[model samples]
Target: MSCRIRIRLTSSVVICLALIYIVLFNGLALYSLTKSTYTPASVPVNRGRLYFAYLGFNTWKCKIPHFAKQPLPLTALASFPGSGNTWVRHILQQATGINTGSVYKDYILKVVGFPGEGVDNSSVLVIKTHDWGINERKRYQRAILILRNPKEALLAEFNRKNGGHIGHAKTEHFKQSWKPYVNESARQWFEMAEDWLNFTGDLHILIYERLKADPVNEIKSLLNFLQIRISQKELMCVLENMKGRFKRPSKNLTNYDPYSHEMRSTLLQYEQQINRTIDKRYRYTTRSHT
Candidate 1:
């Protein structure tokens, strides 16, 4: 009887110890899941784990803010589609701790993270707009124009319209709609640049390639342009969480050229005209400042 009782006590102790270990392990895991920080370089490349880690990690790192308490000057974030406008908005939101607004109601964007979609009021930091025509330009007293290379912007827009953000256009899209779309898109691209360059309001031009090359300094310039003050800690947080959810993944380069000879010629003509207009505007601005 003594031996049997001793065995039972030993079993009970073992079971209790097992429960304690299990509890401690799970507690640690939950802590890591909720509180862990991630930088672009720090995230591991394991696809399955990376997806979940990003969902949990980046979303919690930056606190999305409510609408501004006081009325603000309605500023415009004007860009042609696929010119990294959404990415810029994400960066601004991360840094300023205020929601950015858009004129168009993008339900997908609203569901993902942007709470200020379709709101064009004074509560938003800047109202996003693709329209650079005079009528649309008149709505804002200040604007930031984001310009991207025509080739890249057009292709990116095509992919976005045909597929969801971060997805590629299907083969059918390239074969059927690519040529005509390129012609129409190129015209709009040139017009967008020309119209925004002539914007009478306080306007700042941001080149997409330059922003990619030096994100920190570029973003600093952007903040200065918007006259938004941010602490160093907040700026660092923006750097850490720079890439918001909408950025498309890099595509594999192939030897095939998507643009035909005729398409290339047409695009080049518009691109040159846009460049000339921008140069003239830059020179005029420089002379005016002097």
Candidate 2:
């Protein structure tokens, strides 16, 4: 064969190999994105790879008709479980008339939530999560850290698990007395709080007590932080509608009280530490409606 013919053949082979490599690499990256959970630590270094994988995933996701049509900055409402996440989400949805998303259902479960509803043209998405596995400040546009008094929060959780009462006789799942459960719950709460409190990203700290005391104003502050707008009338309307919706019989059903002197002291210590860390690391203050 002539030299020109040989050169053409070599060029074609090179092009084919390049195409194959691109296909294989992108395929592997997409697979990884699907299977693994995303954390700041685990984020791929290759910007190009992550970009394409996200694009492909979104394209596939858009097939669902109910997905948000506009892409918005993802805003996260993050907290440990039983820390009033659901109530806050309800308020947010009611105030804005926009559906908030959940990463647990969307990312972890790969069900119809958040980004799974697929990419839309929406300007904002609010997601709920109990995960502190990733550095959220770096990932999300904004994050709201909702906290409650650990003792109350843990008691609420215990009661919820025990079928709306705390003093149920020890069962298989909760064989230990209430004290152990509360202690374990508090430990988990502190661990999650520590992980998230260290985040240097845009964050707003909300106290559940403050919200309970004055939901309208507290929700207004939250909406402002999120850059969401709602009129005074609308805000009041939402609050009025949501009133008494979250009241639980557990509050009256449980004669057992765990907020003893020791528990109070322990929680106070953790709160002080958390407060100091917040003061040092974050610009946002704990909401005080007093």
Candidate 3:
């Protein structure tokens, strides 16, 4: 071949190689963008893939329609503080194969009931709360309300240290805290109990003591109301998982300061009365629902 002709042929080969590299790189990048954790914006509304004929590399441009709505399951787990919802949640986490090892931050963790945190959200969610929330938004279902006799709840409260504000000890010390006197504490609890028992609602009430005493059946009843199906094997696994404590990090401790010993002791003084109040408020039945 003439020198000029040979040079031209070499240049053409280089250009073709460059173009092939560019196309391959772009295709891989597009595939990766689709699978990333952060959702991609420009990848069409539904489905679009550039399919290439392997033998010739001829590509077909295509798009697929996306379904109109995404379905996510939402359920509410509401309980009086120290009513053993921690154990309930543990059972759920184990059965779902959700958290493989480390804890998974649930996308829909919200506090409902007293001070509702998830009052606004588009995602399907599960909420944990003590106070009952009125179903004004039309999003919430009738609740799974767990009740512990206020007296036992009071004892369990100190043991689990699950009190929202009280758990703070307002201090890192778990001691040197401020709280209503024990008598007042008990009175406050009982009063809160009274409030809960009398408050009528479409609620499936599960007694906590009964759950601890007989978990499998109590849980089945609880799950039935929620419409969650569980096989006997899954039920056994869930019960096994509920035995441990789920101690989560508390941001509340960061901001709250400990109170003087006097303050904590004073709160202890009225604990009994508070507890009694809670005991009285601890019940509701289908009859009341009627």
- 131-241, model 1: which lDDT tens digit per residue? 877899989989998888788899998877766566677678788998889979999988897888888988888888878888888899999988887888888898898
Rank the models by lDDT, top first.
Answer: 1, 2, 3
Clashing residue pairs, candidate 2? Answer: 68-120, 69-120, 69-121, 70-120, 70-121, 70-122, 71-120, 71-121, 71-122, 72-123
Q: Best candidate, lDDT-wise?
A: 1
Candidate 1: misplaced stretches above 4 Å? 1-60, 253-255, 284-290
Best by TM-score: 1
Please report, in order, the local distance difference test score of every candidate based on alpha carbons.
0.76, 0.60, 0.44
Per-model TM-score on C-alpha atoms: 0.77, 0.63, 0.44
Clashes of each: 0, 10, 38
Error in Å for residue 13 of model 3: 45
lDDT of 3 by residue, 1-290 (tens): 69999899999999999779767755654554455332232321123454331223211111111111343244445655556665555454444432111012221121101112323232322345554434421334454556665444554454334232112222432443224333444555544444444444445666666777888777788777755676887777676556533332244433543334664454344444434544555433321100
Cα lDDT tens digits for candidate 2, 80-114: 77688756765665666565666543231132122
